[model samples]
Every structure is written in C-alpha cells, then in structure tokens.
Target: MHPENTNFIYVNREMRTLSNIDYDITLLDWLRTNLKLKGTKEGCAEGDCGACSVLVHDGSNSEVRPINSCLVRVGQVVGKGVITVEGIGNEKKPHPLQTSFIKENASQCGYCTPGFIISGISLLNSNKDVDENSINDSVSGNLCRCTGYSPIVKALKSVGNNHEEIKPIQFVEQNNDVQLGLVSYHNPINLDELLNLTNKPNFRYLAGGTDLNLQRPIINEDQNTIINLSNIKELKNIEVQNNKLLLGSAVTIENFLVTIKDRIPELIELLQRFGSPQIRNQGTIGGNLCTSSPIGDIAPVFLALNAKLNIFGSNGRKKVNLNEFYTGYRKNILTKDEIVSSIEVPLPKKDYNLFCWKLSKRYDQDISTISLTVYIKIRDQIIDDIHLAAGGIAETPKYLDNLCKDMKGQKLDKSISLAINNIKNYIKPISDIRGTADYRIESFRGLFRRLEKCLVDGVKTMSIMDYNNE
Candidate 1:
C-alpha cells in the first residue's frame, strides 16, 4: 500500500516556500482547514465543480492552467507552485478581473466567484484580448446555481475592455522545515531519474490527474505508488519538425489549443467542445489518449490523422501508431512500467480534405453518442486514398479498413454507397443513455452523406468559428 504520510511544499506570496505537517490530507482540505484560504470554496469534493479551481504552473513555467484543488493530493505539490484565489490580490489592491466582477454584479451567492475570477484571470494572462466566446468557454466548468451567467460574462468583458496590465506573480520558495502529514515527494527534474523511478512495479504515472483524482482515496490506500509527471519539464514541450507536430505528455488541452490554433484552426472548434473550461485547462492529451475511452474526442482525430505515440520505460523507448495503441475496451497496449512520453501527428497534404463531427446530447460538456473522423485524398474526381474512424460504435475507436479498401480509386458516388453499406455491416454499437442503437447507426449514415456532400460541393464544413460560438 502507498505510504500514509507524504510531504507538502507550498510557495508563498513573497516567493518563500514552506513545508506543511501531515501529508495524508488533500490539497483542498489543507487549504481550507490549515491554511484558512476560504476564498477557494469546495462545491464538490470531486473535480467536476469549478468552485475549487486554482492556477498551477507546470515545471516549464511557460503558462499556467487552472486545476481543481479538491482532487489533488497535498503530496503532489512539492517543488511546484500553486496560485489560489488568495494569491490573486490582497485587500489593499484587487486584480482587475476581481474589480470588474464586483462592478458588474457578477457575484450572486458569492460561493463560486473566487473560482470564476481565478479562471478569468488565467484566461486574461493567456490572451490579453478576450472575446465573448473565449469568456464563455473559460467559465463553462464553473456552476452557479443562481445561473447568473450574463453578469459574469459582462464582468469578464469589462476587464477585457479596460486592458489593464497585470504583472506575473512568482511563487515562494519551497520550505523543507515544516512537514505536512507525510513526507512530500519532490518531482524529479531529470528525465532519466523520472524514467528510472517510474519503472518500479507499483508506481502510477500521473499527468493532469483528471481521472486519477476521482479515485484518489483508493489509489492512496491501494498498492499503487504515485509518480506525478506534471512537474517534469521535459514532458511539457511542443515542437514542429519535418511536417509533424510533437506534443509532450504534460501539455494540457488549453496549451494544445493555443499551439495549433494558427496552423489547424478546425481543431480549435473541436477542442472547445471537449469539456468545460476547467477540464480543458487541467486535462492533458496524453492522459486523454491513455484512458482509451471509445468516445474520447481526441481518439478518432488522432486515428484519422495517423498520429504516433512515443513511450518510455526501463526497457527503453518505442514508437507506435495511435490507432494501434488500444487493444480492447478500457485497455491499452502499454505495460505496467511504461508511460507515454509524447504524441506526433503528421501534417495533412495541401489537397487532403479532413472532417470531424460528434453527436452528443448537449453541445458542450457531453460525451459523444457517436463521433466520426474522415480524411480523404482526391485526384481529378477519383478517390486516391481514404481514412475513416469512429467512436461510440464499437468497443474501441475503429478504422474502416475494409471500407477503405473497397472505396480506394472508386468515384465519390460509388465510395459513398460502399462506405454507408460497410458502416451498417461493421459497426456494432450498444444502446446507451446518449443514443439508441438504431439512432447511432442512422446517424453514422447521415454523417457519411454529409461528408460526401461537402467533398462534392468543394466546401469545408468544419470551422474553429463554429466551436467558438458553441
């Protein structure tokens, strides 16, 4: 079983770091109970509610992302810095976002204000000129029972209008003197050390902790050892080399969106619909892919794009296609000691046409009932090559290999009919809360038809603007 006592390292306002006593508790409990930082409220003990949102800087310190403190273990914050609501400003001086929120009457019950204000500040830090859509996406995770969304939106807009210059705040140094519950584990700065430590049998590799945090109690008491990758600097890099985009495992969905927005604008729309703003900020692409959820938004897109995954373990490094990464339902090809290091996606050719669509109950914050990703290469009205993938239709995200084989070199009309026929014969989706079996089947056919029409009309159906407005 995991150790009961872990260490806690906290950085203060003056850039002074301090250690806490007793590490058995969670960061949320520590903040509220010990530190008395009541500004960070606990709407839900789980990560679902944004009321506990706080900004945390990864090892790189290039940008900050919002994370839910409730799900984070106190032991995980060692060596890194955390910015809670209290850190935003003091009573003598308030942050522009805070002032705007109050002036706009954004706070109703005031329970969720701190979280929303912190999220708003993070958004402003990332982008000085915030649009309405960005404001909406940033606060989607914060739930206000009073439903006073308009005023909050107005408050954010007011801050953007003023365009105040906000200085960056540095976290205090780590204090090793004070102990918190258990001795905290400082994240390894070197990749070699990280890999060696992670090769141990029971060590759990954690990135965003969106999923793992849900089972924190079980993981804490179980035989699993924890190794947080969030503090590893090497794993947060993003680079483009030889027409392929390489994303480090620690890169969050928020950073990914910023990196690719200019090059692949269509992806921005798809990403905005992924989850609430809080989820996007804390969830990493590596963790999302590793989860191997059939309906995961990034799975089919990766498959359609022919992405590659780089993995590391004691045995050394290996590379494989993202499509072949999954073996079964909720299962992957990764060994116990192996952790994904990075993902590489090849850029599409100039003439290549790609499209993606998701059928869900709600436009945002809903799992896909059926998701489809299509990529096609056409030459003079003839199909050169085609790749298609779907989730929520089978145990795993599957590529239509047989369909591609039959449709290659065929005309668009023939290919469309063959694709529709193949989907009916191949896909075996189960009935679930989001969709019925028949509904999913028919939706697949309709999506295929729409893709064909888009190709024939010479129009691009997917747009970043579409998702921004959603």
Candidate 2:
C-alpha cells in the first residue's frame, strides 16, 4: 500500500495504486491488460454481455452490487473496493458457488462462468431468498451459450445462500477532482460545486454513465473534462413528500423499481423490461430522461403520471413539467449550466387504472420499437379521465393529451378505437432499422386495441415474461 499516494483502490482486498491512467481506459481494460487479470472476459463491450461483470463496493452503498466492468472508468472506482473472479477463490480453495458449478456441470466452454459466479456472490451477499425465481433473476444479465442456464440455476440452488462474505470497510469521502495525464476527472461534492464546474470547456455530467461511457471517445482522443454527479447527496435520494414520490436524478433504475414496486405495481413489468440486471443496476432514472431517446422506456410511464422535473443552475432552481422537457430527438430544455435534481411523480388516486407496454423484437435486452402508457381514472365504470404517452412513434416521447381527451366520459368499449386513430396526427415517426414507420403506426394502434382487452377483459399478457419454472 502506497501511503504517500492517496489515489488507489482496494483490488481483491489489497490497496493498489493508480498513476497516470488514461481517461478513456475502462476498468475492464485495466483489469485484463494492465493488472493482467484476464479472468474477467470481454464479450460485448457495450455492456450487453455480462462476461465482464464484477462486484463493486463503493462509499455510497454498503452492499456490493454487480456492474458491467466494461462501462466503468478507472477514476469512477477510486478509493473503492473491487472484487473480480480471482478474488473469489482458486482451484484448491474454491468458493462454495464455484465448487457447486463444477459439481452440477453449470459451466460449459468456461467463458461466462466467472461473471455468473460474481453475480451469484452478489446475490448471496444480499438478504434475498434463495429460491428458483430469485436464482434465475440474479443471473438474468449473464448469458451462457453452451449451458442452457438450467445448470447455472441448479448450481446456485445447490450452494444456497451461505456465501463467503466480503469484509466490511470504512468509507472515506473523496470528492475532489482527479487529474490524470491528459484527462480531468471532476468529482463535485455538492450541487453548487457541480454548477460552478459546468463552465469548464468540453464538459459532461456523468450520472450513471451507462450511456455516456459507451459513446465516449477512446484514450487521448481529446482533452475532455467529465464530472461525476454520484457523489452529491442532494441528487441521490428517494423519499415521498406530500402525496408525491420525489426520486433523485442519481437513483439507479433498480432502486427505483424496488422503491415503487408496491406503491405502483403496474409499472413493475415495464421497468423490469427496461434492461437486464447489470444495466438496471448502473443506469439511473435521470440519465434515461436526460438522454431524451425516442425509444427510452422511462419517459412514457412518467409522462402518463404527469411527472415534474426539478432543475438547478447558477441562477436558482426551477420546476418544469416532463411534457415540455424534450424539444426534439435527443434534445431537452436543459441549458449547459443546469442539471436535473429530481423527478416528482404524483401518486395516483385509488381509482387509477395504469397500463404500460414496450414492443420489441426480443423479450429482453432490446431497444423499444414502440412504448406506451395509458392511465385512466374510472368513475362509475365510465372513463372519468384519461392520459396517454408513447415513445418511438414521434420525434420525441410524446404525450397524447388531445387524443386521450377525446375518449373522456366514453365507456371502456370498442367504440374508443375511433378516438385512438387520432394519434396519427400527433405522432411523426420515421422509418429506421428497428421498424418501418407504417409498422410502428399499426403496432401503436394495436396497443390501444389490446388496452380494451386488458382493462375490460382483465388480460395479463402484456409484456409477460418472468423467471418462473415452467
């Protein structure tokens, strides 16, 4: 351990010094190339494949969570603890899960076993139930081409929940800027410090970094200054206030799902389809909105709920509705100096009937071709109020205020299909690689047609994919 150099991380329970590391250098590359720890394989570098998964224990949370090492930068884990496959065990003193994998023949071709083991370790570290569904869900992000995943699930089940526990460590605050050779990695402790650093040229706010890191340039490609917002306490909270759920911009998508699962259980399906386990663990709710992707999964549901965004800048804080936040494709109303602090979603009334869906080619880890959310308030079996929002059917995630209003006071019958046709005038979708414009339009209309079957007939087939032992 280098006491003189305060820049180091706990790699496998040992402090390793970091010196002159490249800015664009990912933790995967550093582990495989620099440290010679090639156990963490690289499959799809964009974080879809969990071959590069690892367990990281940061200062923000006491629990060790699984993250895609390919998407994590070197500076992000400064002073944190990282546990790779080597950290788990060896051939002589194999960990319980590793031994179980061998006994049950869970690993084939031996490529994705390390990541699955790491994910299993993370699952056991937590207090989750050791059952068939939980075991399947824990490794949903990991893929095994040779082994049909039944063996993997069996291995985890055989071992049960008694995992080799990771020793707890004290967390010290490291909120200052990190200076590499050609990169300036800024870590602002508070909102004011974050706003002041916004003046730096070529600046970008790093929230979950699930998107930005994928599109960032390579090492020494340009002198870029990136700021990490995960350290700010004001932007990482989850609380309920005055009948509204206030979700901080920095709250992970997984955390959001856990917090609102009981309150708004209807949204659980859509958020579960949002991404795999690793993607959900790293991507934040704010990053999903700020990206303003036309195919984003978070926007449609929030729009149907009429969420409000709290923005802050040097001038002061301001509130803007979600409908007015996006101006065009991937463009939002935020200025260079402003940052979204949190999202305010009003709790619905008891009569609220919410429906959310995302149409995609695959059941998991695929982009949305058409995402829809329809919220209806029922009064005496008639449609008292209605709100609809959709994505991938326009230049931006659109709110069908006028079209949904046309269905107000109408019975929840097939006659409402006439009003649903008006969505053609509101949306301006174009053809692309995902689907053609006509396909999107027709499919968009089909969601409403199915909506009737859902609300009236009580169908449970909307995005229905679960980790059940069928």
Candidate 3:
C-alpha cells in the first residue's frame, strides 16, 4: 500500500475514492469499481478501444475534450472534472447524441453504443459543421463486431444536421473542493511551479495520458510520482510568433487542428489519422514525441516541417530539432526530470511544397505500415532544397539526409529516381505484420514517382479515392 497525505484528493462525489493507491489502476477501473459507472465498457485494456471514452475538463475556460479512460491513471483525474456516459444524461432524458442513436437504430448488441454516442457528442459539440468523413474518422477507434456502422453514421450526421443549437450539459463546478489521491503530485497553474516540480527524482510527467498511462505501470513503481502538467496554463497555448507556430504541450490534437487546418491542410489530414476522436482529443503533441514509436503518425510530419521542441527541466529551457530528438527505436534524448513544454513549427514559404502519406492496410485506426513525408523547394526547374523522412522503415523516424543530398541540385525526374534508388540502399527496413521490407521499399519508390509528378505538373491534388472506399 502507498502512503496518503496532502497529495491524494478525497473524492466527494457519489463514488468512493481510494487513498494512497498502489498498483497503477486506470481511470476506467476507478469509474467502474469505485464510482459504479459501469456504462463505460472496457472493450480493450489498451488505449486503442474507445469503449471507455470520457470527457475530461480542466475546470478552465477551455472546451472539454474526450479521453480514453482505460489508459488514464485513476490519480490523473484529481483536480479535473471527469464526465462519464452516466453523467451525460439519465433514463428520463437522453443526451442528443444518445437520442439520435436510438432513433436511427445505431445500437446493435449495444456494446459499443455508449462509446459511439460519447464520441459523436464530443465531435458535434466541438464543431457543429462536422462533415460525414470527419464523423467517420472521429469514431474510427470504436469497433462494433455486429457491424452496425451505417446507423451509427446516420445518427451522428443527424445530430450535426438537425441539432444546431443544442446546449452542452453543465456539471457542477468543484474547483474549490478539488481532491487528489497522491501527495507528491503537482498540478501547477503556472510555468514556474511546473518547472520546480521537475527538480525531483522519479517524476513522471503527464499531459494527455494517451501514451504515458499504458507504459506507466511497468516503469518505476517505488519513487514513481507523476507530475500532472495538464493544468499548466502556459503549456496549453497556441500562438504564431514571427514566422513560426508554437504549440503548447497540453494543446490537444483536436484544438491544434482548428488552429492550423487552413494554413497546413496536409497536417490536418495527418492529425485526423493520428488516432480516434477520443485519442486525438486527449493525446498531446509532447506525448506523441515522447512515445518515440517509429511508426508514430505525427513524427514524420514534424520532420518534414522542420519543427523544433522546447524542453524544460530544473536546469532551465532548451531547444532540440525534431529530427534529432529521436535517438533510436522507442528511444529519446529526454531526461527523467525534463518535460517537453512546447513545439515550434515554421510557416512554409510560398515556394515550399509539402506532402505526407501513411501507407497502412486499413485507412482508419491502423498503425502506419510505412509513412513518408517530403518537403521540397524548386528553383529554375532544379531541386533547390529537399527534406525527406520515413517512418516504419528504420528503428527511428530518420531523415533521409544522405539520400536528399544525393538528389539535390538535380532535375526532378532523374533526381527523384536516384533518390528512390538511394532510399532502397540506405534504409534497412524490417519485415513486420503490416508489410515486408521489399514491399515498403517499393512503396517508397512509387510514392516518390507520384510526388515527382505532382511537383512537375504544379498541381497540389490529392486522390479523394485514397481516403474513400467507394
């Protein structure tokens, strides 16, 4: 058992909150076991399934975002407001999304119904003008073995089309009575307090809990005290400075999409494919980088855009290029006492051409088999400068620096063919379930050909059929 003191919050709601909890139990378990909110199912213990979706509000003026409770630690929701499906509506009056689902016969076997309803409601509440494709992409992580997607899609579209002025459910504010389960945990309101927390040993920094919660259980259990950075106001900001865009570590993918969708449309597509609505709403850009998965959907985009990360610790702040951040497969240069405070991406120039593509067997809710991102600038029909990166081809998301160097100053036709050939030589791709080394290599060549055509034709066109089944 763990010792409880000023760190733990005494939950006063209708549930019994545990104190000094050992054994990293998830927020989903806390809801079902302690809170008796069994309406939220545990379809998958991992974060992949959206069955345990919930809305986590920081008690600030910012909008609420959906999260997967299965991976969230029970202690992480201390000061924040957690809204489960039970909190949304009662038997007498259902939530608009819930009502629409029933009317459209969206629930078959009813296992994934609550999750779909919660995700749909979150998306619609966030944006009333949600399109059908967005709706489909938002709920992609939710799986109904019964194959009742048509009605679910119908229900979501109906809510967006018909319910334009639906007011969101208001929960009682409990900021004054905020209680947490742990003592050493710090929920800093400012940057100074957040930086102070980093001075301690055995500190686990948390933002969105998309990646941390899953890997937290096996880390350091003895001195493992988590520093919840979600409440830091400075780290939740998004602003443009000079010619660069800075995104705070706590800025959710859903929020970032709204800010830069028009400016970087290709990035918007990548964000849509990052994860499901619940994951995107909860996952932080910092968390994505820290995960350091070779197949991370966001890393390639950051590489192509030449982004920089601002990391803060006891020693103060430091910056690192996104390309150099990843040291190896599932490895990073982050220190235990350090936290990624923000990410800076430069605005593309007029002549800059950017493209990103993810090759996966399934379009939605599947990891990238081989992802590639290219940023090229051409002058006088000669390749002036080019940045190329590929994921799932090596241990780390590596920039094809040597290959790009080989192709630079050459014509697009011969240079691209040489670049493709060089990639086959330089990259040591491994055969995984998603694809083989040969397949990934060939796919990269094909992508190079298509990208070269786009550059030559001077047409920024994307195949609608690429994202559509029909």
On TM-score, the candidate that comes out on top is: 2
TM per candidate comes to: 0.88, 0.94, 0.88
lDDT of 2 by residue, 1-470 (tens): 34643877777877777765755688898888878899999999888779999988875456888899998888787778888999889988999899999999998799999999988988888888989867777787888899888888888988887777765454553555676657788887778788778778988788888898888765666787878988788888999998889999999998998998778888877887787778888899999999999988999989999999999887899999999999998999998878899999987767777888888887677899999888887665578899999899877998888777778887777336665667577677899999999898888777777777666665433554421221
Cα lDDT tens digits for candidate 3, 1-470: 11333232223223233554545567888778766778899988776778888776643434556788897776667645566777667779777778888899888788777787777767776754678777887788788878468888888888775553323333333312123333245567778877776667666677888776666553343656667777778889999998889999888887887887778776767777777877777788778878899888878878878899998877888999998898887889988877788999987777888888888887666789988888889888789999888899998888888888888899888898786777667688999888999999898888887787778888563442453432
Candidate 2 positional error at 173, Å: 4.3
lDDT of 1 by residue, 27-108 (tens): 7776788777788999887766689988776333546667788767666665456778888876788888888877888887
What are the runs in model 1 whose C-alpha is more than 4 Å off?
1-24, 58-62, 90-92, 161-168, 171-186, 198-201, 222-224, 463-470
Candidate 3, run of 10 with poorest lDDT: 6-15
Candidate with top lDDT is 2
Model 3 CA lDDT for position 112: 78
Q: How far is candidate 1 from the true structure (C-alpha RMSD, Å)?
A: 4.2
Error of 2 at 389 (Å): 0.4
How high is the CA lDDT of each candidate model?
0.75, 0.82, 0.75
